[model samples]
Target chain A: MDADLHPERGMFLHRLNPVAKLLVFSCFILAATLYLDVAVPLTFLVLAWLMGWLGARISPFALLRRLSPVLAAAVGLTVFNTLFYGGPREHLILTLGPLSIWREGLQIGGSIGLRILCVASYSVLYMWTTEPSRLVASLMQQARMPYRLAYAVLAAYRFLPILQRELGHIQAAQQVRSAHRRQRGSWLRRITHYGIPLLVSGIRQAERLAIAMDARGFGALPTRTHYVRTHMRPLDYIFTATGLAACALVLFALGELGLLRSFLAGVAESLAGAPQ
Target chain B: MAQERLDLGLARWTTREIIVMAVISVALGLIFMAYGVLYLALVPLLGQVGIMLLLGFYYLTGILVPYIVRRPGAALVSSFLAAFTELLAGSPFGIAAVWAGLAQGAGAEVAFALRGWRDYRLPVLMGAAVLSGVFGYVYEYFLLSYAVLEPTVQLGLFLVRIPSAIVLAGWLGKVLGDGLARTGVLRGLAITRSAS
Candidate 1:
């Protein structure tokens, strides 16, 4: 799955254990969720983008292009919140005919939108740097996932592209066979027709592979030796420390500005004051 | 005594079963990517509540895999893997996708567990799908700040999701599983033994 279209380029994040990266990035995402203010998550989003550019060696243009879909989602969310917001309209931001944007709605929407983007940036950065095999290896060694399940994931990961190609083939075959029919019917029918063939071929190939693997004594023992190790170096700890410090720094700055507000608290307040 | 023995029997996972579940997840992961695209396109026209109509797509792996594999953890493992696959496939939601997967999978697993890992009837499958919908909704309620929305809109979102779960994940999963069973590809699996 990590076809590495944009190769790691021997960047800093690439050297850390994927698990360590997962841990650090998760903190940033968790922080993104807790705060209701736009600046906190926006800061995190900028920091994530900087990490992608400086540490991960991802080009700025490429990052934007790759994240274009997220941009759309953020924009959609902002627009939805700005328009349908049922909050007090005391601080109106705009009035484009029947559609009016209020300050409260805009703040809430912008915060959530930036929050989504911030989360996606960290996730994309992690996936871009980490290799699938190393991730599975790390999960097994560090996370203590069973070797059997981990190997199954690796095998299935290897089959993804093959299954995609088979799906294309099935769609083509079904289209050719049904060219005579006038009505294509509902989307459900189309899925079942194509889904059955794709699943059958996939299961058959999986069974054959499973048999081959078992014959080789794939899971003969409870524990297996790792061919590739994903060790957490001292640098990984330092990197995690840096990420935590950055999060704390942002929160402290926001707190000093009196802008740090818990999103859950705000929601609870609104619900409490809402009409029954 | 019989129940304890049955629990022991169902707990073990064979290599074939694990591989098959993984394969099914990868396929469904691809389908999920398609649904993500369709979802973004429709969100503008349908708004938030209408988009719940597609939430069922997310639960397919959870419901279908358990019904076919009839294993205790099949739903949870398969759905989690499917979500992981989607994340790897560049899902915009990223890590949250896996969390949602875990939540949905656990909800579906509860339904199967209630049946003692035995029944795969349509009703049981539908029950599983509905539970998955409910679980997913609770997650989104906090994550997306659904609580801030109007009570009516929230209710509408919850109401629309149930039918979507029923038709898309539950009914559709059973249909696909039955079709695959007829093709004889599922010859060695538990589904075949139970059906015969």
Candidate 2:
């Protein structure tokens, strides 16, 4: 919600076409998916983070702060994989209950966690740098998406903040009414008491918004003048092409290194190579 | 004078109503997002907990939002709002949230759409649940499950997920909605009885 986190100017990444970025990002994900190598994925993740710092001009610490939840989840996943999803590798790390903690499982889990982190980081970078309106515009202009559908999606995006504000107001009122009631009730009871009014109000608001849009001539025109236009600059093409090339090269290198086969074999080989 | 009063009462900014609803939606969204994060985080510790938790959140949103708003897109908006909250909260699921939100929203919307935008009875709510559950199953099968397991196991898991979403999440949502209506908060909204 902070405007500073998504600044209006001076971010190089923001200037590129959103559709291009989306394509490039998808390529990266696809390339990452083709192989199971942690190195390639980790490298990509690092590169993304660096791009966020250099291209978006965001502080690394601020970016990391935003990414803390993802990091925690990744760590949790790694731990879980290490303990429970033991692979067929002969290298045993530990044992618990019926599950044998193998080196391969841990390695595979760590690789998976890294892959997720990489993908997520790149996506976060895209979203943080690009304004939703510009992104929608790029989609329409560059990708030739139907204007009507694009507009509808944009309208929905625009309404999101208003809806958030409305939802906040609803919760406060419910808390006040329930203040006199004992707080010792079960979680289910409390949720029921509070959830009803909010739901009713949200529906009412949506209805009003629908009416308001209709009244204002939204969706009335099949074609409308562009309030915002997105043009694909030379840099956009360069960025897209370069990013895709890099992603392809990484995939090729990963395959050549035999890490791809190891990755596809599941947790078995990953754990075997973990300690080394 | 009476006409003027009626217009004013109906059309005026009722800050109290707006504030109350806004707060509830945001709070519920935050809770759902948190649960989603926990579910994803605990996937290794608890197999399939992430899917179940996500389904539970969707079910709750579908039931609660429609019960209160009693209008078109309420369920859809609620489902998406919950997803948005998760994204804002920095979900580990990343951009998958976008697709998941779309699918979940559509599921809840289909139920309301089927009733011709008129009914909000228990059966209607159940219909919404079933629709949402089925959608969730299809979504997981293609998007998440396919990458991890065999076709048979994936299909079986999908079956498990659907009923769990319907019975656990869907039923709970309906019960919660009804209970709240009984408390008189939903006095303004029209209430319909179940045909059964």
**Top candidate when judged by DockQ against the true structure:** 1
In candidate 1 the C-alpha lDDT for residue B154 amounts to: 72
The CAPRI quality class of candidate 2 comes to: incorrect
Displacement of the residue B172 alpha carbon in candidate 2, Å: 4.1
Q: List TM-score per model, in order.
A: 0.92, 0.69
lDDT scores for all predictions?
A: 0.81, 0.60
lDDT of 2 at A245: 84
Candidates' RMSD to native? 4.5, 8.8
Q: What is the C-alpha lDDT profile of model 2 across B1-196, one tens digit per residue?
A: 0011112121222323333333344456566666666666666665543355345555666666666556666666556555654544445454556556667768878888888767776667777877777776666543321333323444455565666676656777667666656665555544434322
Quality of model 2 by C-alpha lDDT? 0.60
Off by over 4 Å in 1: A1-9, A87-89, A94-100, A179-183, A274-276, B1-11
> Least accurate stretch of 10 residues (summed lDDT) in model 2 chain A?
A1-10
Clashing pairs in 1: none
| Model 1 Cα shift for residue B142 (angstroms) | 2.0
